[model samples]
Target: MKLAELAKELEISTESFIKFIQDFDLELSECIATNFDVKKDFEKFAKENKSFLKKYDADLGQNKSVEDIAKNIQQPKDKVAEILEKDKIKVYDNGFYKSSISSYGIHQKLGGNYQFVYDYFGKKTNLSERDFIGYRDLFFFISKTLDPFLHLAPLTDWGIHKPAGIILYGPPGSGKIFWANKIAEIVDYQFKQIKKYYFGTSFVDGRRANFNDFLVEMMKEDKVLLFMEEFDVIMSERSEEKSVSSCDEETKEIVLHYVSQFEKEDLLMIGSANSLVDIDDEILAPGRFDVTIPIFPPNAHERAEMILHYLKENLSKDAILMKILETNNAHHLPFWKEISSKMKVFSNTMIIDFTQSLKKKIRDIYLKNSSLKITINEKLLESAFREAAAKLTGEYLNQVAQFLQDVSINNYDDFPKRIEALKVELDSYKMVEKPIKTIGFTHNGDQES
Candidate 1:
């Protein structure tokens, strides 16, 4: 069943259902496929909450003012307004709340119990079976940033136009491109990468090609998201100390020329950068690529979930690797948590490397002693961990530190927890000074023979 069909059967508007999802931070991709196939969990949730849906729709249908909401919910008008303000809800000139507000939302403001909803939909904060492992805070933050694109009320009533350009800043292997594609999916836009060759005058099939022409064609499409990597280099600040390459300068100029029209043309441009320090001030202007999201390496808890996810994704239940994991209880997240805690400041790429190395080591061990049962002991796990940790060098730590500084300046309040967690991890790599001892000369001054 499609979400629209489910909404119709339940006698509710699709927008109401979508609002409920947004309020709860549920990704439509998890509950509904591209072909509009609704997941069984979501369908069952809708069917079981028929009365709730009807009441939710009815409450949203009422165009209530602050006083009306206060009266209905038996809260003070000042309190109601404060809650709305805290949530970033905007009202009209007549003082009525936006259509996006609902009784469910008000109840949530009053601290009503909604664990049942999360329990039914599967908690987004925990380890989910979805493609991504964990980063509930980042996902929620990104969702809010994309809200203007999801609903017109933010744009129409609040003057919050969709972001023309966004920069995903983080260290390498932190999945900047992954979030770019995720934004494309959420907005129902076509995902297209702007390649290096596209920046230069290149030939395709003996035909002349240029970025300006390609961009014009892209704007002609219904809705499109253009992703460009190495954004820091391409949009580097102009300076006499370090000159920008001609190719990069040209590309930056072309983008600046067309950027103001992105929202009008139903287009969005996302830039992926390892660090934001080098991005030009013009590029970071209010109406330009002002919004910056910081992607961090997974923390210990998330690293464990990622390891378990990779293991399940690659190994079959009956495979030898699975057997060994089960024998040592390594198939579960708790077992991986012990080892993941040791991998301080490990990137998502390092987690993957650890899994691959572990698999190879296990395979080699099994081949050497076919008749013997292989135990997943510390020695085996440490060998793989050491190999993966090789990538966690001083250079990588410095990159992480730089990323932390950039995020602090750009988006500190939006993600303090992530920033703090990453800072702690990076601090773990700091070199502590030890007291040095002077050469011994005591009563045995004869060279301490």
Candidate 2:
């Protein structure tokens, strides 16, 4: 029904009716004749909105407040207030305060529809639980630690608090970020990337206030997975040697703030860094960031999994996946499997690089020599894999590989020092000079190293 008609029928003002429609996050261009007709389906929409209002009312039953309910439901009270809007819900005369979501109606909306909720906030990737390969032991560790509170059990009946913090320390492209994201996906929590760019402002007071406000806002969410990459930049152990910037002090405050929250809230902070030892002792102790994991290069089986995945993902358009899987063909699944077996201890990035290089090699050949046909066969992929493996695994080159994975471009000031340190570390091991040998893969998956 049109706003005027609905208002007249219900004996309310037109402004009031319009306000009701606006509650559902609808924007009006204002009622020209066509604009009014465009909203003809308002009746059905209003019914759904009525249900949400009813749920909100039930949530507030027995004169319960938003803050109490927010704590009970693990949602930020401010977020509840935002969703409920100030018009429909009462607000404090002085200012805003924290709140939580306590209504079962909201829970009904939230229970099985995490993706929907995240979609309302913003769309997530289509990556599912299976899409996250490896990290089996780490997954178990996370689940075991968080099992106490990572459920929908009633708060009044049982004791529950925010789960312990987790630090995923690894070299770059070791899958720390990917695993953290997958964890958030499976847990069905709000996933937020703690972008360093947000803290790049120069004004001290503004920086401190911004950090404080953002944390306050984040706390209101029901369940949040905060992923901080290059985490040591902000949360590294505060040292007297460092320059005294206001943001430094502010960063210290925020780190301490999250530590306290982790003890009693539902938020989970997942930070990734080059090394766990770089973090402060207090933060790494029993309660805050209790789990410090070291993710290393993938093992043989894991490397194989990653190799097959990337190969299919990038080269599938050329029907290379079929050649690998088809048993009757000379270059079949076992041939690929054996290739993956040989790629032991390869980093995930190296596998991706291998795929790109292999594809580029073929494309270059096709361009340079039009008469030579490029076939996506086992031998071609095997040769590319062999070539990449030789470069990544040789004695001095292995040290270089580690250096590339461990160092970030932002550490330009310390690059020389870091390189020297790594060189010394590599030098400590017995030096062995060996030829970079390339292995040839056969139809039967036999290889000569």
Candidate 3:
């Protein structure tokens, strides 16, 4: 019910309702003034409660008072006071409040600052380090390149000194963003991530004045790292036609300007692109991006390490199976997450059993989908399932069958019925079956049917 309606039903004005809440020692002044409906208030209350429960590891039923909550949740009294003021959930000196007000406020403030900075500077912090591979060589390179930056000493002319810009070029799934973040963190500089679209816009506008303003602000700060991901769209060469105006030209010019400025001001700039050759010659020339780091696809050794990392953190046991399934050139993180989610349903100790079970599941899926009577081992089954799942399409019943074949079932016969039901569900989308080739029996001398 709406607060106003509830207030009217109780035969009191909103202000009076708020006062009544205060009497109960649960502050409602702000909530009443804001006129936020009861639904929103309840949601906020529930979220705060959950956060409090998680943080304190306390049982909600045991505590009902704010003082009890503050003590249990291990938050400062002032922090609790602020939450009471904002939520208008009457906090009697004894009422329960779950989330720390100061922490929540600080988090929100930081998020807002990030958003404002991103809007103005066209940069964000992409600090997900889950994709770095071949740690030995990469680490060696990082240690070497970042040594001077870390020590706050001028590098020799051979070293990367006052680098205007550096390019991280490689195939997708290469750890460009991860490396960029590590560099920023090591240097104790603010890392800003800029999206591809922002660069495209900057290119067309001839000048990203607003973005430049943000960059200038960062310049005033002690140290900053501006990371532009998918840099090809902006830094790529413009068309030869003088009359033609493309966003690419404007982007290159703006980037060039920034690179030159950074060189003069001793700022660090990094750009990442999948296609290195697409980069504009003007920007790639001597002063702009002098150091070009090619982030090659992970070789066998790196792949092995990445597989082990995923298994250690995400897998229960089945490391062998995880390694087998970690093929296909797509990004590794999503695949790892999917496998991790799948493994969660089974017992951690039973990973070997689960691996065998998954193999059977994949075989069943393949048989149900494909016309070929192929004999698939556990490893093969796992690979097939991974591939099908990776590239599964709505139109392909076989792909759906391949994915669902391994799922747990209480009734085996009902599985087919469940599949039929899925077909019916998919009928609304006008999905068509992909044609499959008929497999003919191969014979040397003996005839086979």
Candidate 4:
């Protein structure tokens, strides 16, 4: 059964059920397949926790104002407003808070007794684990995409087969390659990179090589996830108006010929592309490279966690840098939130760049003043921040904007909050002021509201 179907049976909204899962910190993989199929465990849990689910649905479904939240938590309205303001939670013009703003998180922040929620649900688990930072939504979405491989229901019941090809599309430095490998792990396939030399006609070792022959050998192997980079350029739209390279043209033809045999042969091909705008329609049709997952830059919260992960995880516990971070509460998420807020739309590479720059500066300062305790302050952070943000040039901004456009068309419903967050970040770079636009997918086409 689908998650929506389960929610309907339980007499609650699908949105509320999803929120409940998130608030209670349930493992998405344990609850539902990427295709929204209700896992047996989650279905059982929901039915058994009937009373708790109703209360959760009632509380979270309501559009809450400061007074409403204050009353529920037995706090003064003024105090609630102050706490929300300090935490940078937005209050909508209508006086109610945005639905995305978690009242449960706020309740805990303001010292409300949220023990009942936790006691019933057991201890909550964080969505972002050590191996993966954020992108819980993306993880769930991709899980569904891998359903044909992960479960037999999709194939046996729905006649859906494993995709032969998938394209991971996003701006530069968004970690498309990382996701390609992750897909391989989830499907339990051997991850192999298809080097550029194997594309068309090239020499392998000491002999002539052809991509078709290479693909044939790969098909002979047991369960392989073949990753190809520069996919957009290699499989660009074939048009008479523009000149197409012989190699690229031939590569496209060979892939089209072999893609059908991939699923039966237990071969999965993943393409990494920076943009999807130029890719040919045939490459995106069903039974081809139709599955496209957008790899977004880390959000504000993710940025903070990522920075802290890079800094503390890399340094020794008793290291001077660790001590410096400790002094300023840099070990905590709150301390990094302020700095991360300034780094909207920064890719993972840029976050690493910030950490690298910050580390070097800390090292330099400690060297010059060996006897003195080096303080990590705004002055030092600002310098490193500026250096890291240098890559946020106009060209990068344009690429992000294009990514937003493409994702809205393809996966809007799957990631509304991310879309809005990225749009706000992208708009920050605009020279002229414009209201943040709500872009949604419609049956007709993309409509702005």
Candidate 5:
């Protein structure tokens, strides 16, 4: 839809749409000469303009002209032009007036919607619950780093080095790959997934040399995120002495050179590895990876939420069983997915009974092994659910929940003292949990056991 067509549809005048285009540029010939279909161009322009106008609606209400609004927003004229062009608004004549179509603008186009790998997974595949602590922090850090570049001209230097690199290292299934994809989506950067063979091949075969060329071309395209999974292949520490024939030193050297180039050019680079301990120290030095984040396994609270989300999508009726199995496995995504699939195969009534039986089995297992009783009361369960939900949503509500859960579960003997200590820490965040009151002893009546 050209801006004029959109305006006509919305009952807006041609003069108004032309004025919007003029705010971006005066050269109508160049703007409309590009090859874009009128409807597609108009849709693109409408989306971008909606976002921009919403952002600066107050200023627009002041009745400023397009030029004045662009100046006030500090956005480039080309960007404004792109937005207008997307809306099907175009320059007629040199400055005179004629109606014609042209190419759509990239800047005005909306990036793809936020998506997750689990979305594409089979319905039967139960994805593990996500641990929100690391995910939220990771998102915040990346957002802060990329915010400056999002709205400005591609040419404007945000002091971002080409090939800007970030390393995410942790255990497998710890959400490293998921986080990388999410970051690319959030930042509106193109993600190029690099394969392991690209790094593992012998230099003599030209594999090592070809990788560098590929990266250089990718960087030149501007605002691309190069994601290297299993980065350990290229970044593992070199042996004390050089190894012969089978080992290739050229691969390491080529990787280092490109990494250095990326750092210098300001291109974004993101690498994922199962363990940082095995990675070479040289690759982790300041310039190569400006930031390193660890994606740790999910905690109890996160597990609960992961279970809940999985159940809602896969087994909506079996809430009780979902909680029990999730708490027991609380380790990774696959387990949740697996159990959920099983639960779905059974009858609804059977699902409830099966969940109860599972909970009993888990409790019996714990009871037989331990000297101390680990009771999960309503209060504790509620706390875990809340914490997990907050993390999943990327909200930082109470920082102390994680610490308390760790202390309580890992150190049962000292739980009381630790809880007291945690209370002091929680005070800092204005989070106060009442002490669990002991009403009476067990039915045995031996001092209310």
Candidate 6:
């Protein structure tokens, strides 16, 4: 959005606005930046003067009547008159006193000065085509929350509050952080991240001030999305742990403050974590994260698509690639599409790394080499994928199984008994170590069949 486009929407003369910005002490370059914040200066200016809004708007447009001003400002007509009287701003006539007399006023006498300065910036999202690998239903459900009637008070009659926040909880590398920012972009809200460890002594004492500033600014917008990554660092379930650290106490205080404001603020707060099972239930109760979404490592079909996302640029329609992916044939895809799918429970990050290494391997061996034998070393790619995939799947699966166990076992008296009972079921999902895990590769880059 350029200054000229902004001026058209603001209905202000570009020249006058350029000069008026000097009042806020902003350089011309700063305002021209992509999606800059002008409210900070506007609020400062408004506080400095009692009758600034009316005077500010009037300067840009015709002096608006009481009814016109009330409608434009979204205030009652009577309140407009009260402000006029309180500020001593007047319209002169044969006798002056017009609030009780007429429905409309003379524009010239009113002094044309109306300007629509109150802009609650909220960008509507148009993100149907952007794929986050999978989670198709999750994105669709989130997008539906942006309906015009989503904020309507009438819907609350059903016992569901208008969605104020959504929590995305899943194992690490499930791409919770990616989806959070994607949601922000789709909904056209300014995305801001909250750090994981602010409660430590190394952190500033005025941490609450920083939070207040962000929350206050967020409330100013019609829709704003705040992303808190790795939230469990401070918001871990208090009941689960007996001892409360100073950091946890500070986090509790900060969360409580926002909980109070959540009801009134028009915000779409998104919090992401490896798992929210540990996060305090109170912070997410009901309207807080009215929608608690669970994201898992991509399924087999999703994993294949994810691999194609990175490889499609180089190898979608290649049959050898599909063979290495352990598929008979790809119905629709590029050459790099068929890397190895034998690797299970690999995070999207791991797939990305795996695919990148394959591309690099191809570049180094086949694409860069001048030899007549331009065959891909299937065994090398398989080895890389196996090593990467086998890194954390076993450990993470154990954590997930343990978390499920924790959710079920409520009584401390029978905690160990319940865990032991779950141990078998948990082990079934765990990856058992095998002796022949590595692929046999020859100098020619082919597997020894």
- Compute each candidate's TM-score over C-alphas: 0.74, 0.51, 0.41, 0.76, 0.39, 0.53
Ranking by lDDT: 1, 4, 2, 6, 3, 5
**Model 4, stretches more than 4 Å misplaced?**
1-19, 25-114, 117-129, 433-449
The predicted structure with the larger TM-score, 2 or 3, is: 2
lDDT of 5 by residue, 1-449 (tens): 44444545655443444434433332232222121113344444544555443333233234333344346445566765555544433334443212222111122232222122113222332333222221332343444444444435333654443325777754444567777876777566788887655555336455454565666777688667778886765667767563422333555566677776663454677888655555677777876764665444443333433444444344443454445444545334454443433221121222333334445554565668652233434444333333322222111212133434433443333224324433443333332233654332121111111
Q: How large an RMSD does model 5 have?
A: 18.8
The lDDT of each candidate is 0.80, 0.52, 0.46, 0.79, 0.45, 0.51
TM-score-based ranking? 4, 1, 6, 2, 3, 5
Full-model lDDT, candidate 2? 0.52
RMSD, every candidate, angstroms: 9.2, 19.8, 24.3, 8.4, 18.8, 21.5
Cα lDDT tens digits for candidate 2, 1-449: 54445545544444333333322222232211221332434444443345443444344333445665566567777765554452234445544322222344343333423232222223222112134544443443444344454444424457554456777766666778877876676566778987665554435564453666666667887888888887655566767776435664576567676767754556788888766545667777666776655555565555665655565563443463334334324222344566665564456787777767776776676667763345557677777876665535344235334443444332222233333343343333324333754322222112332
Off by over 4 Å in 1: 1-129, 433-449
Worst 10 residues of 4 by lDDT: 440-449
Q: Give lDDT tens digits, candidate 3, residues 1-449.
A: 55546545544343333322322222222232221345445334433444432332224223345454456456666665565554444333655443222232323322323232122223211112233433433443444455456434455544545667878755444467877887776566788886545533244348554455556666777677889876765677656542324655665666677677784564788888765555667877887785665443333333333433433444433443333344332124443344433321121122333334554564475557763333334465355334323312332323233223321121222233233343343233332333643432221111222
lDDT of 4 by residue, 287-344 (tens): 9998899999999988998898888765666888878878777777888889999887
lDDT of 1 by residue, 1-449 (tens): 76667877888987677667656656655665533467887888888888888888888878889888888777778877887776656578898986668757776767878777767766443233565766765765786688788778898899999999999999889989989998898789999999888988988789999998889989999999999999999999988899999889988999999999999999999999989888899999999999988988898988998887777675555878878878878777789888998887788999999989998898898899883378888998888888888787666777888999998888876666677777776765555333553332111001122
RMSD of 6: 21.5
Candidate No. with top TM-score: 4
Candidate 6 lDDT score at position 418: 28
- Model 5 residue 254 lDDT? 67
Off by more than 4 A, model 2: 1-129, 152-161, 202-209, 239-249, 262-265, 314-333, 341-344, 366-449
